[model samples]
Target: MSFATPPGWYPDAGAPGTERWWDGTAWTAHTRPPAVVQHEPVRQPYAPQSFGPPVPLPPARGGGRTRVLAITLSGLLVLGAATTAFLLLGPDDSGTRTAPAPTTSDPAPTAPATASASATPSGEGGPDGDPAVLVDQLNGITLAVPDGWEKAKNTPDDAPTIRTAVSYDCPGTAASFCYRGTVSTRTARAGRTDPKAVAEADITAAADRAYEEDILGQRTHGGITSHKVLKAEPVAVAGRTGYLVRWQVVTAKGPGGVVQSVAFPSEAGIGTPVIVRLAFDADRPELPVSLMDTITRSIRPIGDSATSGGVGASIGP
Candidate 1:
């Protein structure tokens, strides 16, 4: 290939402040300073010529050879340094590097803190003294009911119910006057945050849906007398804020009642508030008068007796 540098003494490519001879070919051990020009007949520097193997020049004198040796050592040192510098500072083959651009996005949602795992049971007991402990995994709650009261599973198709219990054992046995009950829990389909409001809304919706049959005289338990709200107040259940709704109803059996108790979960693990209702029909003589009170007082979140937190779902009161 063609070459730029011709046969002449030029500054050493490897060593500064020194010149190296290139006899129309390869670098030679013959080196000198720029001020020390060879004593050859001065002529124009050799022009580019046919490139081939390097043609060695005659050896230099004692002093000249020593200078060449010295320059060669220094040249090696400088050359090494240059190579290292190139590796560190040289531009990349493509171009310079740059950091990526800043980005903007919505923050990710943080999970709710884990609640205590033990459930704390609180409430008054029944005549037997040993209240019935009821744990509901679906709704994430536990409560005490009148001991021996049977838990039934007779949820309607259209109505939302997580649990059901009766005041008496009615597996298949039917009686005119029996205390039938239900536990309903619901989360707002649209993600309502206010627990108490949602719970009251649930109560209103329930009444609107079944007021005629369940509350009014449209349906009969022997014969419906009068159904009216007797108590409505704020109460805490399972360490959550909620409301207590009591409706007194008169039927053929005697003076019975329906209770709607709702509460919010500590951690909205399911991303919504919860409403729980414990409705009892105590018109039946067989059902104890204190059954409703027993269950309501003993209500708690399902877990160890120390933790209080409820799960999410929808059910009827």
Candidate 2:
């Protein structure tokens, strides 16, 4: 009989009750006696032993192709499990996956810019928390409103004016109020360009306006009777050289008043002349003769630089 098998022990045909080694392709001389068995005796008749075909013997050790195949399949299952774990977890090596940080597409918010306060304009007028100041927006100047004086209400349409706090019935007409002291300002009229000439020319008109009659032809101070010059000289007003004319006047009825006309170049306007007319009742002993000088010195250009001291010749009583 012929057989094809790997190198191992097998049953030998030529040997009885024994086994021999077949080295893969051929029979070998190596042999071993059958292993002795210890068992209970059988009660049946014995029969002759007959060998039919060569049978492979069991392996002497535990290692074989079956064991190797089992190892390979186990290795493949472990590898599959490891690959599944890798797919489930993130790249962190500590076996725990880490989450990604939050992100935003919008830009970061920024703070709003702060705004600053604007400066007051030159041509604007209002009380600067000082009740004694008179702001004149037209001429861009401020006057020190003297004690016992206030801004005049119902002023004539001809000019901006201020007057004494006290008023009484007009001597000639009881229908109106008359102030003992007044100061008015106006832009110089055309053809009266020179300061000295304008002052000289307007003195009489100023006196007439104060003591002669009102715009409605009503005698305010009983009409002027005579007048005399008190002061006529060049003086510095609001940082500009100017001329002033003061007159003491006599009236038809009540004691007459002192009137003055001051002309100067406007500090803010296009070098145009400005006129300031002042009047005070001569009968009032409370009004000082030097009050005109105080008023003239107190005139200042309006705005932040208004506090600067006036530097030049000044008017006196």
Candidate 3:
């Protein structure tokens, strides 16, 4: 006996265990065979799943609502990516915004004509040995003092005196006169420096007092403390040399004590020569600067008449 089958034929000969006939395509006569039973297959229980956050579903395969949803989701993702990129890569305006220019430390150098003077014979500058040679070589303008003119100490401090001139004392007309000289040093002028400034100051200070006394008080009508330079200036003195200097600023002590000081800088040379004139009388203060004209006229340079860089200082090492 043998079993044979045709193409596309099914084995569904019968539902229960029994002999059956087949027409190759369908089952036919059934014959009782043996008693049997069927049971369902056993399966394991499924465990719960875990995830971080809810995620949207993707479109199903083929066309319809699923396809439309897939296209819409893809477009939304692309749009979001573009927006993020634009925000991060945009140009920055903060760096290029300019601020005001910074301020300057000093004013531009002054015009040469107004500050500088003509040149004077150097003679050489202050003394290493010969007093005359020393005097001749001094900076600022040069002034010749009489061979044996009286001299006075302007300051007790022993600070080296600068530009100056020696002459007879003015306090008295006696046989032995007072020793006095107009001394000065190069110093910053009105925001600058001038060699001749000290002499100008000394003259101006005295002139100012004289003018004031003529108008307001008497020569002996004292009441001012003192006068000093408010600012220094560079100017030609006796003609040549450069000078750096300060000025005469008047100080009034209540009404009785007065000191009259005038300063003029000579050109700056090896030493800072200057001319300083002072009139101080604490006990019996002088009311006016009577010697203003005389002092101004008395100034004389020791060397060349041409003035130059007298204010340029070449002082202590």
TM-score of 1: 0.41
* Pairwise lDDT winner, candidates 1 and 2: 2
Q: For every model shown, what is its TM-score relative to the native structure?
A: 0.41, 0.57, 0.26
Task: Give the per-residue lDDT of model 3 (tens digit) for 60-133.
Answer: 23536656756876787688666656555654587452343343333633322110111223343322232222
- lDDT tens digits by residue: candidate 2, 1-317: 11134443333455665544444544444444432221322111111123332333323235385467568767977886666666666567785775554433335333221100011223333343345666554454667777678776567664657788889987777888888888888767755669999999888788877888888888977888888888899999988899999999999988888999999986543345788999998867667778888898788765534452222223223
Candidate 1 per-residue lDDT over residues 156-239, each given as its tens digit: 432234333434532222332234555555444445767667766766554332222343323334444566776677776666
Q: Worst ten-residue run, lDDT, model 3? A: 42-51
Model 1, runs deviating above 4 Å? 1-133, 157-179, 204-226, 250-256, 266-268, 282-290, 305-317
Question: After superposition, which runs of candidate 2 have C-alpha atoms over 4 Å from their true positions?
Answer: 1-129, 304-317
Top model by TM-score, which number?
2
Overall lDDT per candidate, in order of appearance: 0.45, 0.64, 0.32
Stretches of candidate 3 off by over 4 Å are 1-149, 152-155, 159-191, 194-236, 240-265, 269-275, 280-288, 305-317
Least lDDT summed over 10 consecutive residues: which range in candidate 2? 111-120
